[model samples]
Target: GLLPAMALLARTLALLAMTLAITAIKVVPLDMARDSFDDQYRGCSPAMMAVLPALHNFEFQVNPLFTQTWVKAEAEWRKRGSPVSPLASPAQAVALMAYTTKDIYKDFNAAVRVAGHSRQEYRNNFHFKTLHFLLTKQCHHVFRGVHDVRFQARRGQKVRFGQFTSTSLSKEVAQKYGTDTIFEVQTCHGVDIQAFSFYLSNQEVLIPPYETFKAVLETNDIGVALFLNLVLFFVHSLDHLGFPKLLPLSPHWKVSSVSPGLNVIVHSSGSFTIL
Candidate 1:
C-alpha cells in the first residue's frame, strides 16, 4: 500500500513537472479560471494581489507551509478557541454559517459581488475565506495561503500505519461491487489564498467596507468547485447511476460511491489506468 502511495506521489510530482515542461499543451485557457476579475480593480490585499494571478505557477509563493508555520497556526487556533476540527463542509455549510460570528461580515459588500448575498446575517460566510485568513494570522500558521496546490496536497496526504490488509477481497467481488459504480475521474485542486479583486468598483475599493473584503475561504473555492464539477460531471454523465452520493462522513475527502475500475485519478490529474 505504501508502495502505491509513494508511487502515486512520485507520479504527481512528475505530472506537475510535465505540465511545467510543456505549458504550451494546456487544454483550458486562463480565462475560465480568472473569470469575473476586472483589469482595473487590483486585489485589495497585497498578499492576495501577488498570489492570485499566479495560481498556475508552482514556483511562486508568498506563503508556504512548513512545520514551524503549522505549529504557530495550531497555537493561534487554540488562542481563538476554535473547535478542535472546525465543523465546516459543503454539506454542513448551514452549520458553518451558524458558527459564523459577526466579525466575518465586516466587508459585506465585497462578499456580495463575488457571492450573491449582501445581508450581513444570511450573507455568505465562506469557510474557504475565513479559513484562509485564519491560517495567515500573525501566529505564523504552517499552512500557506489557499493558492498553493502543493501545500494543500501536502496537507491532505495521510500516512496511516495500521493494518491495511486487503482481502483477496475480490478482483471478482471488487469488480462486481462496482456494478453500481457511480464515479471515476480526475481531480485537481489549486488554492490562491489571496482572492484579489482584479477590478473593484469605486464602492468596493474601500477596505473594511462590506464591499472590499469578500468572505474568505478555507481553500480556493473557485478552483475546487471547478475541479470537482469537471471531474464528477465527466464521470457521472457516462454512468447510469446519478452522481455518487456525498459520503455522510469524511468532510476532508471527496467520497464517490462508484464502481472501482482500472482508471483512477489522484490529486492534480495524476491518474493510473489498470487496463
Candidate 2:
C-alpha cells in the first residue's frame, strides 16, 4: 500500500512537470487558466515533501535548452559592457522561468497579476522559499533602484508583491503597459536578467517575492502618476517561528535606463536551494 502511494506521488509530480513544460511554450486563454501553477500543491502534507524533487526534475528537463541560449546572451551583454544580473545563475533562471511562464499561455498581464496575488500564502512553499533565498542570498550582491508597471490603481495600499515579479532598468518598458491609467513602481531589490532571458530584449530586473512595500508617492499626472515605493527586503533564518532579518542593500548599482521592451519574470531554483 505504501509503495503504491509513493508511485502515485511520483506520477503526480511527473505530470505536473510535463504540464508546466507544455505551458512554457503553449498559448492558452486567460479564461481557462488557474491562478498559479503552485495552487495545486499549497498545503504541506507529508506527500508535499515531493515538491522539491519535482522542481529539480523540472529544472533538469529544461536547463539544457535554457542554458544553451542563455550563455550566448550573457556573452553578448558582457561585450556591451552591461553584464546580466549576478542573481541570474543557471538554477535561478529556471526558477524564474517556472513562475513567470507558468501562466504565459494565458494573457501575459493577467497571468502576472494572478500569479503575484496567488503567491501570498507561499511563504512555506518550498519552491518559492528557494527562489527567495536565491535572490536575497547566494548571489552576494544587493539590488537597488528597480522600476515596474502595474495596471492596478493601488494608490494608498500597503502592498506585498507575493512572487518573483519583473521590474526593469528602463521606465519606457514600464510605461508601455498603461495608456491613461498606470501605476509606476520603484523599489530596491531587482536582479538583471537580460542574459537569462536570451529571447527577450527588455533589460529585465526581477523583484524577489519576499519583501514589503508601501505606496508612498503619487504624482498629479492624468491617471499616470508615478507610484514610488520604498521596499525593505528581509530573510527568515528559521522555518518555524523565525524572526525576519533585513538584508543589506547597496546605495549604488541602480540602472536608470536600457534598451526598451516588456517582459514578465517569475519562479524557483533547483534542488540545492530546496530543503
Candidate 3:
C-alpha cells in the first residue's frame, strides 16, 4: 500500500511539472514575438533584402527615359556655358508621381494617345507632358532648389529645351511651402522605394511598405500576447483543479495510469470514484 501511495504521489508531481512546462513553452517573449511578426508581415525575402540598399541608392539617380528631355536641355545649357540645373532625380520623380493628383497622369496619357504616333514622338510627348505637370505642381520642396533654377526659353518652347541656370530659392518662395508637405513628399518617396523593390524582387509576394508592416506587427503583437496569456490562464486553472489526476466518479468506470501499478479510476457521472 505504501509503495502504491508513493507511486501515485510521483505521478501527480510529474503531471504538474508537465502542465508548468506547457505553460512556460506557450509564454512567448514580447520582443521575440514582435520580431517574428515583423518578418512575416514584411515577407522577408532574402532576394529583396539583398537588393534593397542598391535600389534605394538608385532612387537618387534620374531614370534615363523619364529625364531624356531634361538631359537634352542640360547639354544645351552646358554648351551655352550656363550653370545647368540637374534633371529631377529618381527620388524626386517618384515623389512627384506620389504627390501629384491622378488626373494629371490620366490627362497626359490621354493626350499622348491622341497625338502620339511614332515611338520617339510618344517618348518625347510623355517627357514634355510630365515636365509640364511637374512645373504646374510647383513642388519646389520635393525637388529642393531645382524648381528655382531658371532657363532661357524662346517663345512657345518647352521649359526643358531652354538654357538653364541653377538658382537658390528666396525665403519668400520657401515660406510658401509647409513643412508637412515636404514631409509627405519624403514619405511618398520611401513608399515608392518599397514599391519598386517589391516589384523588382518580390512580384509574386505582396509585401507592404515598411510603415504599414510596422503597424500590422504592432496590432498583431497585442492580439498574440492576449491569446497566449489566455491559454496560460486556462492551463493554470486546469492544474489547480488537479486535471488528469482527479476525476468525477460514476457507475461507468475509466482507468488511467498515474504510475506503474498505480491506476486512477474516473466516472463520467458526477461522483468521485478513486481506486
Strongest candidate by lDDT: 2
lDDT tens per residue, model 2, 139-170: 21222232222223234545544445565556
| Candidate ranking (lDDT, best to worst) | 2, 3, 1
lDDT-better candidate, 1 vs 2: 2
Cα deviation of 47 in candidate 1 (Å)?
5.7
Q: Could you tell me how far off, in angstroms, the CA of residue 174 lies in candidate 3 after the best superposition?
A: 36
Shift in Å, residue 106, candidate 3: 1.5
Computed on alpha carbons, the lDDT of every model, listed in order, comes to 0.23, 0.38, 0.27
Could you estimate the TM-score for every candidate? 0.16, 0.40, 0.15
Instruction: Identify the superior model by TM-score, candidate 1 or candidate 2.
Output: 2
RMSD per prediction, one decimal?
25.4, 20.2, 36.5
Best by TM-score: 2
Residue 7 lDDT in candidate 1: 98
| Candidate 3 RMSD computed on C-alpha atoms after optimal superposition onto the true structure | 36.5
- lDDT by residue (10-80, candidate 1, tens digit) is 99999998666444322221111111111111232333322322221221222232222333434444454
TM-score of 3: 0.15
